[model samples]
Target chain A: MELAAERHGDMLLVRVAEPRIDAAIAIQFKEAMRELVADGAPRVVLDLAPVGFLDSSGLGAVVAVRKSIGPDRRLELAALTPAVARVFRLTRMDSIFTIHPATPGPEPTANRQAAPAAEASLPDGADEA
Target chain B: MKPEPVLAKRPAGAPRHPPDDPAAAGRAGAAGRGHGTTALQASRAPALQAPHCPDAGGRVPQTCSGTLRITLPATETGVRRGLAQVFAALRQGVLAGAVARDAAQGQAGAAEPVPQVPQSACDRIELVLAEALNNIVEHAFGPEPPAPATESRGVTAPGLIALDLSAGAAQLHCTIRDAGRPMPDGQAPAGRPQDIDAAADLPEGGFGWFLIRRLTLDLCYVREPGCNRLSFVIPLSAEDPPRPHGL
Candidate 1:
């Protein structure tokens, strides 16, 4: 899995570079987010646009990341794919954080379109884990 | 590492037709179908059972129900997919029922209204299932293929297998069994992302355990006697509860 982090004002956009956020990448996600937080980025926006799925472990990592930051530092999620979003919805985590839409809304980016096109370069089933 | 032979008990009772028909099928379509559709019917595990279990343990004795069994060579891939399919089917039904129950009770304001489960949930579950089954088939059964004739008959010894499903009131309890050299206690896989090292980068080698832990609400592994039983619970949606009365 690949991850890219860029600063946008006070917020940092961390795009999870993977097709699926099942078990194999859940730990890496926690470590990466911890490092990013330690690097002094304040507000964080997880761009889950690339992730097609998130299981319980993935959910735990996101929750852990949220817990890692101080109260002053805000963490938001963006562009949840349908499959991943279903997990959040099922577990009721969707209510905990500020989720942005595909396009930035009055709030941040939480729920996006019904379905987004797969990345042109990523092959189907490439992200098996 | 030679593959082992496995065996499964045939489904119970006389075969019945699919729910699509309560009555018997026309003679033409019924030709080779024995014990009918309800017994020994080929089913994709995830979509069907789960709503019937009343409690945990996945066992509903005294109820006249058909037993669904599977015996595959001890390959991780087959075991993972097979297990996932069974779980997905149960979870799907349970969740759907839950969503419906909430809707009927007009609990729209209650906790996200149990949003309609997207087809993506089903697909994701299927993928995860496949991964788990593969792990059992490949690793649990040792790094060897089963005998040809043994595979032809389906059961293979030293194979990883499981089948314990009982349902009650929006809950399906399942007990998955397998036969393999145990991998130490507390050595189950974790659901964290793997490090992207040279070897970890391989797409196929890892990820089975992660998915298994993620999708299951409760997972328990026990090694005793002759087999390994991995038991878990998949809560069903309460809208369309399994009609235990029918089974």
Candidate 2:
């Protein structure tokens, strides 16, 4: 998996380029997030659009990232593919994080308290399969 | 001295194997015709006999619900081969049990129900087992063989690597042990060491241990005098307790 990060306003957007995030890479996922949070970014958005699969380990790493952001800071997950979304449902973590459905339009605007997402169209190059 | 076969006559539809067949030793591909049925019959004994362990420390942990051990040479290839064999057996056993239970609960022509842990879990099992076995190959095998290993050789000392599998009512347990030096301080030999403060954006090593920790409910590492042992357990079911109380 490849993780790329950039600063946008007070929020740091970390994009992971990978096919799956599970036990195979959970450790690296945690480590990469820890590195991103070390800068003390008040908000972080994790783009998992590239992820094709997510398991319990992947979920735990995301939770750890949320905790790392601290209560004062904000953490959000974006561009979750349907397959990845199923994992969130399986573990019921969908209720815990801000999951912006991968919409066909531009990236969803950042909101400190992310508004609840409604089913939306898919972005280009993002196949439902 | 010839002894009566512990296995009873094969049942109809059960695969048949000669009493001395090594292929039927492990629960992999060997079709025992009605081996599942035979195993069901065997399981009825309920002698409370736990799986065997070759080493004293190989004893099942108090938290473990059940345990089994398989022996293979302590070589790179041997460790890999042994892991594949044992893991397949465990998965097959669980799959067979689920199938038998569903069939027994229903009549013929009924749909064969699927297992909770589907075949997809096979990949996850491989990932988890590989991490545990890697420790044995690297740390347990020690620095390097005093002499180069060759494929044709047989029965030579290949150091000491043992695969121990235990299952709690709610969890699946795997332990790998080797007679090697104690783990270095904060520096694991085989994979990345535990790091709590590393960056989240950089692509780097040190993810395997973290994956192991996240994948398993609990992990324990022990360096007793001569052996380095690593054990990990994952909950067997989403609804079941990790292990039976007092087990």
Best by lDDT: 2
User: lDDT tens string, model 1, B159-247?
Assistant: 44545554433344556655565546635665454442332122222344654565555677766555566676544331221222211
Writing each residue's lDDT as its tens digit, candidate 2 over A101-127 gives: 642223545421122221331222221
Identify the runs in model 1 with alpha carbons over 4 angstroms from their true place.
A103-129, B1-121, B124-175, B179-247
Error of 2 at A55 (Å): 15
Best candidate per TM-score, number?
1
Please report the candidate that would top DockQ against the real structure.
1
Q: Given candidate 2, what's the lDDT at residue B227?
A: 59
TM score of chain A per candidate: 0.77, 0.77
Score each candidate by Cα lDDT. 0.47, 0.49
Can you give the lDDT of residue B22 in candidate 1?
13
